[model samples]
Target: VGKIPWWKEAVFYQVYPASFKDTNNDGWGDIPGLIAKIDYLHDLGVDCVWLSPMFESPQKDMGYDISDYQAVYSRYGTLSDVDNLIAACHARGMKLILDLVVNHTSDQHPWFQESRSSKTNPKRDWYMWKPARYDADGNRMPPTNWRSYFAGPTWTWDELTQEYYLHLYDTSQPDLNWENEECRKAIYNEAMRFWLDRGVDGFRIDTVNKYSKRTDFPDAPVTMPGETDQPAAEMWCNGPRIHEFIREMNEQVLAPYNAVSVGELSNTPLPSQVLPYVSAAAKELDMVFEFSTIRLGTGGPFHGKYLYREFPLSELKAYVATWQQWLEGTDGWHTVFCENHDNGRAVSRFGDDSTVELWEASAKTIALWQATLTGTIFLYQGQEIGMVNMPKEWPIEQEYKDVESLNFYGEAKASGDAERIRKTEKGLKILARDHSRIPMQWDASPNAGFTSAGVMPWMRVHDGFKDLNVEKQEGDDESVLRFYKKILKMRKEYSGLFVHGAFRPVLQEDETLFVYVKDDQGSEESGVQVNKRRKALVAMNFSGQPASLQEHDLDVAATLGCKHGEELLLVTTLKKNDFSRMEAGVLKPWESRVYLNF
Candidate 1:
C-alpha cells in the first residue's frame, strides 16, 4: 500500500509537566527536567511529545488561566529553556506540541485589565461584558441562567464597572469574545506566530469547540433537576460560528507552518457532530479528542463526572464501534487515549486493579487494544509503568489538589450532613482528577525519585509507587513497561496490517471477551486478490476467570478467507503455558493475545 502522514503513524506521549520530573529540586517539574528525560522518552518508542500548558499564568486552574501568551510560567522555566527543549526533541527525531489555551485568559491579563477599565475602552469588545438584569422586586440577577463548568453562575459580577463578565470556567478566567474580528486576528498573528517561529511542532488546542457563543445570551433549557444546575452545554459547545473560527485559525497560522492541530471537543453528542471540526475539506483541525467513550461509566448528565457507576462490556463496545464506523472513509481522524491529566488512571478506572497480577495483565490488555487501533495513540506520563489510582483511605483535605474537587467538597460541606459528605468522599475517590496528577514514579526511593527528599512534591505520590516504579520494571522482561515497548515496536514492524488496515469486530456477543480484527483484504490498491491478504486478530478477556473459545466460534476462515495460523505475536499472560494450547480455546483470566494470520 501507500505511505501515510507522519501524524497518522506517530505515537504521542502526553507529559503533565508538573508531575513529570523536577530538576531545580524545588519540588516542581521544570522544562530542564523534561529535557533531561528525552532519552527516556526516546527509548520508550514514542514519536512525539505533547506537553501540557507551561505558559505564564497565575495557575489558579493549574496553568489553564494564561496571563501572558509569550512568556513561560516562573515555575516551569524561561523562553530559553523552552527553546533548548525544542532543539533537544528535534535532535532526537521527536516532535513537540504545546497546549494552546486561547479560550480564556487569566483576569490579571493586560487585555482584560484594559477591557474592564471602562465601557468605551478600545478593548472593551474583546471580552464578554453585559449589564445585570433586575427583577420587579429590585433584585439583581445574572443576564442568563448559564452556569460555569467548575461551579456557580457563568457570569461574575465585577463591582468596579458594575458589569458582569462571562466565564465558562473559574470566575478568574473570563471567556474571550471571538465574535470580534480583531480578537481573532490578534490570536493568529501574535499568540500563534510567536510559537511557530520558535520551531515548535504544533498545538493541542484547549476548548477548541467552545470558541463561539450564542449572541442572544439566552437562558439554557434545563435538562434535569439538581441542586447545582449546569448550563446546557448544547447552548454553547460547538456553537454556531465555531467552524468558521477554526478555519480561520487553520488558514492563517497552522497551514502556513504545516503544523498538526487537534481540538479538545467536549459535550459532543455524536460522531457526526464532530466530523466538521476535523474534516480536511473543512480546513479545520487535523484531529479531535472526543470524550463519548470516556464518559461511559459515569452517571449520565445529571450527576457530575465524579459520580461513577458500573458499565457493561457490550455498551462499551458499541460506543467505540460507532466512532470507528463513522470515521472509516472520512478525512477526519480520531485520537485514542485512556488517561490524561483531567481523568483517573486507566488501570484503576477500567481495568481490574485489585491485585498486582491482575493490574499487570489488565494494563497490558488496554495497551494492546489502543496500539492496534487505526489512529494516533496518546500515552500519558506514568501510563507505561502501569500506574494506578491513589489510595481510597486518604481524606480529601490532605490529598486533593484540583480546584474542581475542592470546590465540590466545599459545596457538600455546607449541607451540614454526614451522609452527604461520605457520598461526596466516595465519589471523589472514584473519579477525582487528582488521581492522575500524582508524581511520576521513577524509583523506590522517597518521593518516588521524582524530587529530593528535602523538598515536598506539589501532590502526594501514590502509595503503591514502591512496587510499581520505572526503576524496578525497566529491566524486567515481564514488566508492563516492557510490554508497552514491545507493542509499540510491533506497530512499527507490522505497520501495514495494524496501522493501515480496516477494523472489524469479532465475537461481539460474548460477555467476557472483547475481540476484533484488523485485516487489509480485498483492497483495490493491493496487488494481491481478496484471498491473499494480511490480517491480525486481537482477542482480550475482560473478566477475572478463564474463558474458552473454539475455532468455529471465532470463524477466522469465514472472516479473513484464510485459516488461522500458529503465530502468536503478543500475549499478556503470567502463567507458564504452551502456545499450541491457545488453539484449544483456553484463555487465562485477563489474558490478551494478538495473532498474525497469513
Candidate 2:
C-alpha cells in the first residue's frame, strides 16, 4: 500500500540446484535442468529464485569453497548456461539471486594459492595468514586457540612455508582478510559485479557479519565439554567494524545497481544489534536471518551441529513475538523462515513426521503458520510438496554428504564409546544437512525424476518418493502443495492486512497452540475511513491431540470483527474445510486456520 520495495511483497524459493533435476543425466542437477522447471516455480507463486552455490568450486564445503568467483562449476554448466537461466527467470517476471560467499575462498583459489606461496607474494596479505607460534622451547602451536567450524584447529600448518594459515572452517576453505582494502575491492569487482552485471538481480550474502574480526585474534574462552578447541564466535561474530564494512559495500556495489540483498546473519541474535544492518536509513541490508530460535535444538553445549533436543513450540511465541513487535513501525524489516538448505525439513523439525498419515496434515499446519507471519516467504526445495526429512533408517555412509556430519561421526566412532557413537549416529540421521540436500521428488520415477534410472544420484533418494512425489499430489485438492497455493493466494488477496499491517501476539503463553492477530489497526488514524479497516487471525495447533481456545484471551464470536460468523477462507488440517463460524471450541490435532474480517 505504501512505498515498500518489490521484494517486501514477493515470495522467494531456494533451489539447491545439484538435487533439483538432472536433465543431462550427469548425476547432478544443472542449468538446463533449472530452465526446464521455470514454469513450475512460477506456478508455485514464486516471484524470486534463490539458487544455492553453483559457482566454480572444489566442493570441499559443497561449493562454499569457491575456487573461481566469476566462473560456473564445470559439472553444472558454462557461463552461457547461467545467462540463459537468468533470461528464463526474467521472462516470467521472476528475479534470480546468487549465493555470495566472499567471507572466504577455496585454499586452491588463485588468490589463496599465491597468498600461501613464499609468504611475500603480492597476494600474501590477501588472506588471514599468521606465523606459527612456538610454545616457549616446546612444540609449535596455532596463532590462536580457536576451533575450525568443521572440527579441527583454526590454524593449518602449510608445509611449504612452515607457517600457519587461519581458517574458520575446513582447512581447504581459508578465511579472507577484509582488513586489506585492495582485497576487498578485488572481491567486489570480480565476484559480486560479475553476476550483477549479467542480469542477476542480487545476492543472498553468506555469513554477512563475518567480514570483520578482532585484529588481535585472541584465544576463544568459550569451550564445550570434552573439546580440545574452542568456538571463537565472540572474537569474530558481529565484530566492532561489522557495520562499517556493510555500509561501504552498500555504497560501492549495491546502491549503484539498485539491487536488494538479504544477508545470512546466523550469529547476531538480538534485535537491537541487527538494526544497523537492516535499518533502511542506514542503507546496509534489506533484511537478515537471525538464528536464536533455529539454533536452540543444536549447537547448545555441543561444538558442532549435533542435535541436542527438539525445537520447542511452547517457546516459539516469545521468539517470534519479540522480532515482530520490536520492528513493527521502525526503519527495519523482518525475515520469517523455518527451513532452508542448511537445516532439516520444516515438517520433520517443527511438525509431526511420525506417520505417513500425519505428514500431510502437519505440513499443511506449518505452511499456514509460515503464510500468516508478516514477512517475505522463503520456501526451500521440496517444501511445497510437504517433503519430509530423509528416513532415519538410511545409513550415514550413503546419505551423509555434509562435512560437519562426517567429521562428528568419524571422531565419535574413533573414541570407541558405544553410547556416544549410537546417539551421534541417530542425531545426524535425523538432523543433518543431508535431509535437505536429497534429490527433489518430481515424480515416481526410479530416481525420483531427478536423474536416470540406473545412474545414481549424488545422494540416495528418500524412499517416500514412490508415493509422495509431485505427480501424485498435483491434482489432489487438499494436498500439501495445494494448501500452500491457497494460503499464498489469500495473502496476496488481502495484502492490505497481511503484508503491510501491524502484528500482535495473542495468548503468548500457550504451549501447544500458536495464535496471532494481524490487522490494519492504525489505518483510520493514518487518515483512512474507520469502516475500511481490516483484521485477521491465524491459529495453529502444534500437537497430535486436541487443543482448546482460550475464551478470555480470544472471544472469537463477539469481538473478532468478522462480517459473517467466521468468514473462514482456509482450514488446512480439516478434510472438508466447512467451518463458517468463529467460536470458542476445541481444535483437532495439527489443525491450522485463517479467519478474516474485511
lDDT of the candidates, in the order given: 0.82, 0.82
TM-score (C-alpha) between model 1 and the true structure:
0.95
Per-residue error for 181 in candidate 1, Å, reads: 1.4
**Candidate 1 stretches greater than 4 Å from native:** 1-3, 226-228, 301-303, 416-420, 521-532, 555-559, 564-583
Over 357-450, each residue of candidate 1 has an lDDT whose tens digit, in order, gives: 8998898888888887766788999999889889998889998999888877877788687876777788788778898899999999999989
Cα lDDT tens digits, model 2, 234-332, are 788898798989899989999899888999997677888888889889999998888765565674523546745755675777888887677755778
Q: Where in model 2 is the C-alpha error above 4 Å?
A: 299-304, 522-531, 550-553, 558-571, 577-584
Q: Total backbone clashes of model 2?
A: 0
Clashes of each: 0, 0
Which residue pairs in candidate 1 collide? none
**Top-lDDT structure, candidate number:** 1
Per-residue lDDT value at 238 in model 2 = 92
